[model samples]
Target: MGGPAPPAGPGTAGLRAVRGKSIAVLGGGSLGLYLAGRLALAGHRVTVALRPGTPAPSGIVAEGDEQWSAAVEYADIGRLRGPYAQVIVAVKSHDLPPLLPALAALGDGATEYVFLQNGIPWWWRGIAGDGLPRARQVVGVVVQHSAERTAPGRIRVRRTAGDRYLCGRPDGSVDAALESLAADWRHAGIPAETTPALRRQVWTKLMGNATLNPLSAITGATVGELATEPATRAVLLAGMAEIARLAERDGAGVDNTPEQRVARSAEVGGVRTSMLQDRLAGRPLETEALLAAPIAIAEEYGEAVPVLRTLYGCLAFSSTSPERNPT
Candidate 1:
């Protein structure tokens, strides 16, 4: 209901104080590599924990309009022993399970866990339903940027448009650590802020993802392509309406109309959706988190999500078809 809190201290100098603190970044994906490079460049001691057998690169290289390179320490997930200032989980939602037990092994009360995945994360539901351990400090991060890994330990960040990041607790509580992390990210030129209403932010982003992602995967179309076509646009709006209803039922206030969301997507132009990329790459689609989870929530409330259900069925089938080969 309110805006983000102001930064606690002066500009880049205050953010620089975050340096020297140890951070363990889980997952060697695009976003993860980019964050590791940025934090390392900000002078923090960053260690990236990749899956076993992943080639250990000498350092991470970030490229786009401007280039940034930072030397980062590397470790296998099984080898991580952290009493770190923060442990950022940036893996795809579907790839999260195997890493969970390893993360829990880091000790219950030792480190702050920051999850940067898209859609509804598992921890979010735990916080809302069963509640996480009191000792663990969990922060939810919503990243709004276009980034892709060009190679091992190399990433290209295409856009840092707008307030590109949001971090907060699931229970709508203010957190000083989250605010400081946001400030550090901001100092690194990634627009970021700490909000009390993180779930609202999650729902807002989820509204667009629920509709566009699966539709793009099914049709192999770009966001602009889907937005400009009348039939696809209709399906998009219908799916968004269903999700908006579900959001209201779940107690998150999302105040944008379907048309407004479509307009916003149109402005993003030809960028391919992540689901489409995963589908083409023959990787496991994030159907559960982006589609199935929302559908389950809708069913729990006895709400109809005909469009969403149809999309989910199509994606689920495609994800399992023998014709598709894993890359």
Candidate 2:
């Protein structure tokens, strides 16, 4: 799934009509609240879907160098009113199974589903086969922002680097709705663009997560700490090199070397990887999707990923052991 990249920049006249549509954002995580708040402030009728008993904030407050807040309606996942124009999924990969069936029940051929999650998405093949009506359009999103939940109903955007978001069709086809959605995001101060090389982009992001996330989780170190320590740095490079080879085998070759990735990590300094953050918060680690899945693919392609396998084992044990304090 690849093609020429789309033109860059904020808005075009054609996409001005994209606002004020009814959109449902699934999940109450920092990213989800940030997105729902931004979309609501952008004039879209935003509805946030949360699990039962999760507090439905009267409004979401986005804090960083500045502050932006917006009131958004909330709905329980099982009680969502149907036929949304677009459904933005911002849940963790591990939490997607139960939500998938509900999403399928609400979406139809014309409804557009946008997925924003770490690691590989389960619906990469196509949402049609996942019990959804064949008419639904699926767009994959690569979110590059660093956001954290500081408190209930509040989120902080810690860092904004490169493009804020990348949207593309999973099947590598162009859709006007996708382009318009990207434009809308751009107009709302979120740097977003449409790309045809969605799979390559996904693998490129995976290169960093597959290495840094688990390593940081295991060592309880920030990216900078991992980069500067000779021992951890060696493990980091070896794991990334394995992922690079796997990417090549999968025909999604990444150009950045492991050292280059480390250099980029250095720029982020004290920021901890998401897995490490989850560990500290006593939340479940996303090892299966972020680490094990890639290793499984590498094995299927007859490639060795010993470092990844080892990291996966360590993370699996750490997350489950009763004696360990993840923090």
Candidate 3:
């Protein structure tokens, strides 16, 4: 029911067409705050549900290519109660478990649960399979915004241009609410849209992530370094080729070639990947979803992803072993 518009597209043409809707963002990370701030500016009543003990800022401030600030209500995720128009689950896959009950509870009244995770959702089989009612809708977002938290309640959007937020339901069904949100996001200066080819979008994003993220974390390289350095770049291209093959076999082929994906990523310049940031900060890496799950899928299809496997082993070992602990 929707697609991408040309650059310089839909500049607030229908900004006031849709009324403000209630939205609950379940994370206070860079992406979550950026979205919350933008949504509030779009006139939505946005509440960012932060993790317990995390300070709630009086307002959110965004910097870099895009700049703005907005006020949003905050709540401890554990104690969050809601009947918002939609609930955006913006946390990583590893942090999703404890939030399941909140989701199940919110499912009863919220129009949809929008998952913003990177790798395959555990609920891919069916959101309802997790005991969510069939009547409840679930959406997936493929985020292209390269951002990081610069300070409490502040987000630094790293990429200078071409930030797109692609959303779609798992069943590829048309979602009017999402379409409306997309339009408003565009008007608010964030490139966003909904697409029927969501699975393709997921695979396409995964192709880049699987290739760049692990390499970045392992070598402490930024996106540009991984793309330009011959040794790292070779491994990156090899891994991307493997994932592309796997995606094709699964019937959700990536849209671009490995080289094209890498070239596009090079545009991001020296921005550190989320994985690399997590590694440096001593936070748990999302290896299971980003690497293990894909590796498992490859194994099931009798596909070999030796480069990914090697990267995964190194990352997994470091994440768990004492060698990674700061003295």
| Top candidate when judged by TM-score against the true structure | 3
Ranking by TM-score: 3, 2, 1
- Candidate 2, residues 116-194, lDDT tens digits: the string is 8788778655555556535337778887667778777788766535535778887666677778777677655566778
Residue 249's lDDT within candidate 3 is 86
Q: How close is candidate 2 to the true structure, as a TM-score?
A: 0.90
Clashes of each: 0, 2, 0
Report the Cα lDDT for residue 87, model 1.
Answer: 84
- After superposition, candidate 3 runs with Cα above 4 Å error: 1-18, 107-110, 130-136, 321-327
Q: Which candidate order results from sorting by lDDT in descending order?
A: 3, 2, 1
Question: Model 1: which ten-residue window has the lowest total lDDT?
Answer: 5-14
Off by over 4 Å in 2: 1-18, 125-130, 133-136
Residue lDDT tens for model 1, 43-69: 788999977888899898877643767
Higher-ranked by lDDT: 1 or 3: 3
For model 3, which pairs clash? none
Give lDDT: candidate 2, residue 52: 83
